[model samples]
Target chain A: MQPGEQRDEVEMLSLMLLIRRFEERASQQYQAQKIGGFCHLYIGQEAVVTGALAAVRDDDYVITAYRDHAYALARGTSADACMAELFGKETGCSRGLGGSMHFFDRKNHMYGGHAIVGAHVPLAVGMAFAIKYRGEDRVTLCFFGDGAINQGSFHEALNLAALYKLPIVFICENNLFAMGTSVKRSTSLKQIVDRAEGYDIPGEIVDGMNFREVRDKVAEIVDSIRKEAHPAFLEVRTYRYRGHSMSDPASYRTKQELEKYRLDDPITRLRAQLTREGKLTNEQFDMLDKRAKETVLAAVKFAEKSPEMPVEQVYDYVYFNGAKE
Target chain B: MREITYRQALNEALAEELERDPNVFLMGEEVAEYHGAYKVSQGLLERFGPRRIIDTPISENGFAGLGIGAAMVGLRPIIEFMTFSLSLVAFDQVVNNAPNMFLMSGGQFNVPITFRGPNGPAHQLAATHSHATENFYASVPGLKVCAPATPSDAKGLLKTAVRDDNPVLVLEAELLYSSKGMVEPPDEELLIPLGKADVKREGTDVSIICYAQTVPLALKVAAQLEEENISAEIVDLRSIKPLDEQTVFDSVAKTHRVVIVEQDHPFCGVGAEICYRIQKNIFDALDAQILRVSQEDVPMPYNERLEKAVLPNADKLVTAVKQVCYA
Candidate 1:
């Protein structure tokens, strides 16, 4: 491996570990009743977000559906704020107004973690439209699950993005199952990328399990979109280790299937690849794991120490000029 | 001031806002190449270029969400639904996404978008086409719903809607598009504020409150009542959501009776809210129980005479006013 490639792989492994640890802690918090509402962990889908986000510009906007804790962290949102948001605290990214489902950081150009499935797809296209209208070269990376492809919004968004040639990268994290229903049971076409062909936009499927593969494919696609000022679709094939949400028992899939994917864990595979290249030793891997755990624990402390949003301020932030207040 | 059609006034508003702010652009099906479905955006494409005056596909959900996204990123997008009935396809984007984004994002993002189009009962455009959606949109907290009646108000309020920091829904009347009224010159820049009501015709015996397509009916009823020496007042509710409740209550206090005229059906409609607010705030001031003249509860029919029968008109408002006056 080239020196830069080796360094990139190491950084990717570190972020994947951080995301995995963060989500594991989130799952625990949800079970402990510290986190309320629907908690959809991104434990198994870390490589997709981490790899895709690594290829985009810092100013480029990012929007995704409910399962977005990992995406938020990958897009530069601090773990503390994300944790505080999950805790519904005043110091949260959404000021406690949005919990788990909606996470927004304007400074980092992370538009939001929209709760509604496939709803924010058009918004991503619009952001791309604005970028092109303003003559800016920035592209928007919109993430959705395999399930969102079935929504009319996904088709409409793709049509407009292709029609106007908006600079957008639509990344579908096809984790095999959407919520509880497997893609095979719900979608007529098993391949999500095939839907993009109808819109006449370039689309391809990448192995979402491999961090290097996802990162390289996304970088190439995003680079082309930036140059051509058009939208592209990517279907990242990956798996989720956890259930759809904290409340789900995941009875649909068998233990063997879960174990199969566990072996193909993105973090484990990346760590092994780095180790084989001598870029990371066993001590280094242990240190990275220890560091991620420390970061997650610190985030938990921050969230616990964070005060609850005052009851009186519940109606705040409803409008820009304080119309409601 | 010069007499111009309501369509021209709306077109002027779009052209003026586009000229004032480089970030402002118009997007909708037929808004550009076709010069708008109702010619409300006529000549805008030629002036602003294709980039600024975008012509989208028949994808309401797609474009509406796209406009919201653009608004979040700092561009002011004017999303024209051919009619609000068509906006239903993109209702999730309008109702859930646009309005809730600012609050949900902790005020990190403000969607400064305007969704404007010909709305309410018009001619024989039956069932699916004729939808008076003021009540539906106005019920939402974050959205600012405007139903302008006159050409001047159409021009002024639309300009304000484009400039407002929040998502504003400009519900125009299809029937009132060609209705002529005096509007200020483009350089004068007339801008009517939202959430304020205009007493079109002031009187004492009774008040005829209405908006959008029903405003003309109320005005005609007021004129007809003047002949009978009843002295009726006409309150045009330009802004529906942040309703001018004070004006409504003041009119009720003076007249002691009110008859709400709305194009929408009576149940939980704009008239229903007006009636409830009047009773809640100025109950003692009312000398007679308030009455409401609204469209019959049925799907709009394709037959012209039947369509007219289903809608509330000047004669209906006049009769409603007389019943309230006990004449």
Candidate 2:
């Protein structure tokens, strides 16, 4: 491997490890009742977000659906703040107002972790429209599940984005399941990327389990979007090891199916690739794993120590800059 | 001052705001090439060019969410809904996304968007087309609901709605769009601040409070009441959400009898809130029981006579006023 490729592999590996450790810790917290509301973990699907975000620029915007812990962390939000948000503490990224489903960091240009199924797609399109309207070269990266592709909002947003020739990259994390129902049952078109052709936009399907492939393809796509000022769609085929949410027992899927996806574990595969290439020693891999655990534990401690939002302030923030009165 | 139609006043407001602020743009179905569904945005496309005056697909959810997204990044978007009844299709975008973004994001984002369109019953457009959406939008915490009753108020209030930082819903009456009234020049800084009620015509015997299309009904009823020697007061509630409670209470304190006339149904409507507030604050000041004249609680019929019967009119307001005044 080239020196530059080695560096990219290491960075991608670290992000995947961090997201895996953080999600595992969050799962434990959810079981312990420390975290409430819908907690959707991004355990097996870490490569999709970590790799796609690798192509994002500092000024560009990122928005996604409820499975957002990894997205927020990858966008440079501190793990402590993200964990605190899960704990509903005042120091959280959303100041405890938005729990697991909604995490917003404007400084990082991470628009939000929107909860409504397919709602934020148009919002991302709007942001891209603003960028193009103002003659800026920035692009917005919008992520949603395969289920969202069937929504009218998804189609409408894609049509608008393509018609206006706005700069945007729509990444569909096709996890094969929309909550408990498989994509085949929910969507008539099995392949999510195929639907993009209806809107006259370029579409591609990527191996979401491979971080290197995701990183390279997304980087190329984002660069093209910036140059051409047009929209594109990517269908990243991935899976989730855990259930849809904290309360879900995942009764519909078989344990054998879960075990099969475990074989294609993104982090494990990346670690092996680095080790075989002689770019990372076992000792270094162990240290990285150890550090990831430590970081997650520290984030837990910070969230536990953080104060709850005051009950009286619940009414605040309904409007910004005050309502016209 | 000059006389202008309510449609012209709205067109002038959009034109003036588009010229004043480079960040301001208009987007909706038929707003550009079609000159707006109601021609309220007439001639804007020729003046502002295509970039500023954009026509969107008939996807309310998409365009409404896009408008909110634009507002987040320092652009003020005026989203027209064709008619507010069509806004229901994009209700999630307006109620869930636009309003909650500011609070849910902890004030990092403020959605400065104005959703304007003709609202309430007009002619015999039937059930799906006509809707009194002011009460529905006013019930939301983050949205500001405004319904202008006249050409002047339409011009002034729309300017404020476009300039305000919060998400404002300007529900213009379809029936009043062609009605002419005196308005200040387009270039004149004629912004009527929101949350201030206008006493269209003042008297002492009874107070007939209304907004939007009902304001005209109240005015007509007041004239008839004057002929009957019943001094009736007409109050046009320009702003519905940040309702001018002080102005309403002051008028009620003097008149001692209140009758709320609204195009919306009576159950939990804007008038219901007004009735509650007045009775709660100054219940002892009332000499007669508070009453309300509202559209019948049924889907609007297609027939003209049935539609007219379902809607509130001057004759209904006159009867409501007489009942309150004991005349």
Candidate 3:
């Protein structure tokens, strides 16, 4: 699209690698007892948010469920901030009150990392409602897992979004399972995108593993959503390499299925695409991989060194202004 | 000053705020076109237009959370519940999302939204419809809760809530919609700060601490107790939370005996919290065990007679004040 288009693609490859290495490091930190609470890794599904963020403008809002390190990273939040959030330090995003599950970057227009299955869907709709109310051209991209579609809140949000003809997209990252229960056992739809028909919204299924495919499809959907100012549904059918949380043993699925999906791993595919384009040499790829690991290593170190929020100031943010004052 | 009903006061406050700030808008079931379920928002749609005075489907959770989301970026939304009993469907938004947004985000966002409309009992609306609602939001950290017992208070607290940089819930009594009192004109900008209580009828013997629907009840009880030479001070806690304990404490100090009256149930009610605070703060000032005249702990019955039986009555408050006075 630009004279430096290949460089941008190579830069995207670096971002995906950074997220992969960052998530791998976070897992180690969780196991080592540095990061507490439920750590849901966005290990395999980095391409979804990576490409989705590429399609949206900086002012357009992005909100997602708890599996959100990649989303935060892709939205330009520092590795230091994201890592420090998991470590529960004052320098972390959310000032360490929300650990692992809630990563909020207000400046970046990333609403938050909401933990509830379908709670944030309505919130995203409200943001989109504001955009339309103000007659702005911004579109909101709301991400949730397959399980969130079953929630009454999700259905209500879908109806309101379509009815109001708000500029918003509901991106369903169908990673097959909601914690332990598979999508088929929970959601009624055979194809998750078909659920949009019930709300009279445009729906599509995209290959989430390929970076270019996710970016192109999401960009197309976003373009129309912005133009017509209508809501749309996008089913990103990807898989997670790890269990739902760190606690999940993943006994719900077998090794063969995992290996089959890993064969078309998102990062590997993107890396190969760059390789086939003759843009990325083996040495350059190794250097980029090493750079991601070093950045993650430094992020871990920064997290380890950051101080925890003091107990005395715990009441600081309870209200906008002090009631007693 | 002009005399107006509680419903009129609310309508004026909303109109003034909508005119004062372009960002402010009203949204809820029957809030527009229908003129509100209780007619509190009558004539707002014609004045403010559909953009500001909007109507919503009966999707409470969606709309409530939607209001919070609208507030997240920067819009002051007044989301009405028609009846706060319906708010139970959106409890997560009220208790979790709205209140917790400010705190959870490290103060990154302030949900400058107000959730209002008819709250508490109205006629024989039975158990499911009539909820005191204070129990759900009273103790919520990031939220401010206000209940106005009179027209002036209704207008003042609402305007204040609209301007306040926090999520506020204004619990209006459905029964008090038609009840009239003096409220300042729109230009007066009748703004009552939250966390303050009003002393409605000053007395010396026993304090009748109450709010919302109970403020009128306490005033009636105060009148009934006056004939028997019992001068009872009435502490109308207009703002339920960030509670105006100083006013309550001052009232209790002047009137050693106390009788807390609430339209809602007794167990773990707002009265119970007030009782705990009074004893803990001014134990020696309390000459008698602070008694409470409250609705009996049972589901509201549709039978008019049984409903009257469940609600606090004049005789119950008279007996309660006399017992404390005698002790």
Reference-based lDDT, residue B250, model 1: 90
The candidate that wins on DockQ is 1
* Model 2, residue B95: C-alpha shift (Å): 0.7
Place model 2 in a CAPRI quality band. Answer: medium
Query: Per-residue lDDT for B1-327 in model 3, tens only?
Result: 889998889888999899999999999999899999888889999999998888888789999988999999899999999898999999998888988887777778878899997788878998999888886688788888988899999999999999988899999988898999987776776889999999999999999998999888889888887887899999999998879999999999998989999877788788999999999999999888889988899999999999999898888888899999993
lDDT of 1 by residue, B244-320 (tens): 99999998889898999988988899999989999999899998888988889999999999998888977777788
Model 3 global lDDT (CA atoms, 0 to 1): 0.89
Per-residue CA lDDT of model 2 for B20-60, tens digit only, reads: 99999999999999999899999999999999999998899
Tens-digit per-residue lDDT, A81-100, candidate 1: 99999998988898878889
What is the TM-score (0 to 1) of candidate 1?
0.97
The residue pairs that clash in candidate 1, if any, are none
Worst 10 residues of 2 chain A by lDDT: A1-10
Clash-forming residue pairs, model 2: none
Best by lDDT: 2
| Model 3: residue A246 alpha-carbon error in angstroms | 0.2
